[model samples]
Target: MNIEKRVAELVDEKIAEINRPDVFLVSAKLHSNGKLIILIDGDKGVGIDECVQISRYVGFKLEEEDVIKTAYNLEVSSPGIDTPLVQPRQYTKNIGRNLSIKMADGSKREGTLRDATEDAVIIEEKIKEKGKKAEIVESTIPLEQISETKVLISFK
Candidate 1:
């Protein structure tokens, strides 16, 4: 069996008892970097030591199976809020939160995101000037125009 298939099977078995049905592994063959990147995403709520134990266990299993011998980089991480938005689901996580979206036209819009779904989002804003009342505007944006997306962390 190929390494990818073997790794998947091993991961499935390793995380079987762990309460992380959402965990997934992405096997990426980096052409530029010339390395195999295994991206692990899941909220296991386990400490770093536990995660390392899992990796070691997987390594032992793979070694026993003689699937791989050389060492490669294994990146275990919790998906961060600032990760560039890839799918609608990513945007869904940041709903009711502040966002800064870069548009194709080189202009960036910052607002409180009201809602976001598979294809679009609602942005609420207000414009005001001296001696003039504030004018509130709502903008609906399609996902295509979003060049990048990031979550706004509030310190207050």
Candidate 2:
């Protein structure tokens, strides 16, 4: 079995044991030189304490099981704000945030994420016309047609 898959399985088991069903595994990668990276997400957001807890638990389990005979480094954390939204839950959690989305047709749109469903996301975009007041228009884009969606951070 793949090392990353096995690590994910162990992490899932530990997460269940801790009664943190809200936490879900986002990605797991076991790189050369014995570096294991695991990204997790929560319904709301992930906290550093939660990540540390999961990391300690997973590290202990892996060591106890002798999964890695050699020395290894484990890092568990959330996929930060800069990461693109890949899961439906991620879209739902990001409601009301600005998002820059790239469509499969190579078109891009920037808007406030209003709502998200299993099949599509509704975004409220402002339309600016020359010498005219800005108009807010809501558009729904199917998930299948979206190439990528990243949350836009505003310092203001």
TM-score of each: 0.60, 0.83
Predicted candidate 2 versus true structure: per-residue lDDT over 85-141, tens digit per residue: 888888998899999999999999999999999889999999899999999999999
Worst 10 residues of 1 by lDDT: 26-35
On a 0 to 100 scale, what is the lDDT of residue 88 in model 1?
68
lDDT of 2: 0.90
Off by over 4 Å in 1: 1-31, 34-71, 128-132
**Cα error of candidate 1 at position 40, Å:** 5.6
Best by TM-score: 2
Worst 10 contiguous positions by lDDT, candidate 2 = 63-72
RMSD of 2: 2.5
